[model samples]
Target: MARKTIITCAVTGNLTTRDQHPGLPATPEEIAQACLDAADAGAAIAHIHVRDPETAKPSMDIGLYERVVELIREKNTDLILNLTTGPGGRFVPSDEDPAVAGPGTTIMPPEKRVEHVARIRPEICTLDFNTMNSGAQVVINTPRNVKIMAEIIRDNGVKPELELFDTGDIVMANDFLAAGHVEGPAMCSLVTGVKYGLPCTPDAMAMASRMLLAGTEWTGFGIGRFAFPMLVQSWLLGGHVRIGMEDTVYLGKGQLTAGNGELTARAREFIERLGGEIATTGEARQMLGLAQ
Candidate 1:
């Protein structure tokens, strides 16, 4: 029997991918509209990451986040909001010192990392478990930083979707669970195809899936070209799916994606053809233990 699958659309990520995909949402209105479209298409949840309007770079500004949330709520009240707390941790080393923060680094206090989560109190947010070589720069999220951010999210009644890129990240998540920082039936997301993290293979996905607790709920996403394949593989393994231009630029080999709604539609079609039903927002909220 096929289990229920939930489709999540990560509207716009923190990176600058507008040059690669012309339909990437860069402003608050565009981002909110993208979420509404994804929800209308079949996405139970919309994972959002706001970018600076001028530069289209990642931002942790509470105002920008608030505007996006408000816009989405005013338009579509049923779509689950999953904000990104994975920004503000980029640490690019300097060319001169080679040890200090480089030109691209956007490091900040851990509290500032989830400052928007505190103020907005979204239904869900992400917590990157491993900080490793992400291409040329290092993404730093120390244990102390995670503890502080986790405490804030928990206290504010927001759920942290712990992101695990590699197997080592599973250990970190287990530590948090053991420490009682996160609530029961832990929520997690396994990201693959990053430059230095785990590969997007069925074996790797299955290994990480087994590591999750019995009652734990998890989602899987792959970056760049690995997006669709991982979506199918994740559903095959009884996990939920997330996809958007945030993880890929192309709808096909050379075809640039039109929008996040396109990705969500394709994923929904694939899951339904496989005899699985797309979980609704209410079903997803119950499955993930989120208050509807």
Candidate 2:
């Protein structure tokens, strides 16, 4: 039998904007519909991030997340939800006083960062282990803070998808696992193509995959132009795959995808063409050890 590969669609990320893709899902209704459509197009998992309806900016609002979840559950209960706990970690220092936070700073208490995940209790939530320069601001996920968030997510029966941005982050993840901060045989994602982080190259991704602890179920993906290529690379590496507007706006060069469903369909086609089978929701759930 051909290997079954799980595809996760990230509808709207915290960083992707409406200006970048006018069809981006901002409202709760739109976001829910996006997930449903992606599921219809062969995505077994929907990786999510909420945004303000009016401003279209990223939000930590529990109400928005609730609405999105409610809408998704109303139509499709089988699709696995993987919410993000990656917000509230960026720190932009002020020019006037480098010691003080700047306008873009969003650092908050670790507890607050996972508040939505605790309440929603999705099947999975991302736990970032990277603390590095991201654009003008620095994303800070200290070891102590990551541990606190991990405990909260585990307590709520949600799996943490360790988001590793660089080599050091992978080292941190191994340390966390050894210390019992995170469960062994973990679910992880290697995020490449981000400036100052892991470079989006075949060797780079292969090295990172080898560094992961044995039996770790991981997915390797890239941002922007590297998305599709790395998706294929990850599959070749015997890992799962991910795609959607959150990862890229274009389905092809100079052509924007209609929505999450289109991006997911494209990813499915790629996997099928390579002689791999896309897993159904139930199959994916079982593969991840998620409750049926």
What is each predicted model's overall lDDT from 0 to 1? 0.88, 0.94
**Model 1 TM-score, 2 decimals:** 0.97
Give candidate 2's TM-score: 0.99
**lDDT tens readout by residue for model 1, 2-117:** 46788999988877477777668988989899999899889999999987888776777788899999999897888999999888788898888977787888888999988889
Highest lDDT scorer:
2
Query: Which residue segments of model 1 deviate by more than 4 Å?
Result: none
TM-score versus the correct structure, for each prediction: 0.97, 0.99
Candidate 1: C-alpha lDDT: 0.88
Tens-digit lDDT track of model 2 for 214-242: 98888999999989999999999999999
lDDT of 2: 0.94
Best by TM-score: 2
Count of residue pairs whose backbone atoms collide, per candidate: 1, 0
Local lDDT at 88 for model 2: 93
